[model samples]
Target: RFGDKFIRVSFSIPTPEVERFVDAFPKVMAEL
Candidate 1:
């Protein structure tokens, strides 16, 4: 349903929220 290597990310939240996502993203990917 998606194109190659497409990962959706949004920056529409507060700075703290975005920072949290950036911090947690790599760990999430490691489990995937």
Candidate 2:
């Protein structure tokens, strides 16, 4: 797990990027 790194970075990034990442997050987890 990413611990607080993901949580902290998500808030700093653009909303669009975060949304895009959100969609891809599950896909990444599945691959892992």
Model number with the top lDDT: 2
What is the Å distance of residue 19 in model 2 from its true position? 0.3
Candidate 2 positional error at 5, Å: 0.7
**lDDT, each prediction:** 0.66, 0.95
- lDDT for residue 22 in candidate 2, whole number 0-100: 92
Task: Give lDDT tens digits, candidate 1, residues 1-32.
Answer: 33232233344567797788779988998999
Cand. 2 Cα-lDDT: 0.95
lDDT of 2 by residue, 1-32 (tens): 67699999999999999999999999999999
What's the lDDT of the predicted structure labeled candidate 1?
0.66
- What is the lDDT for 25 in model 1? 81
Total backbone collisions for each predicted model: 0, 0
TM-score of 1: 0.63
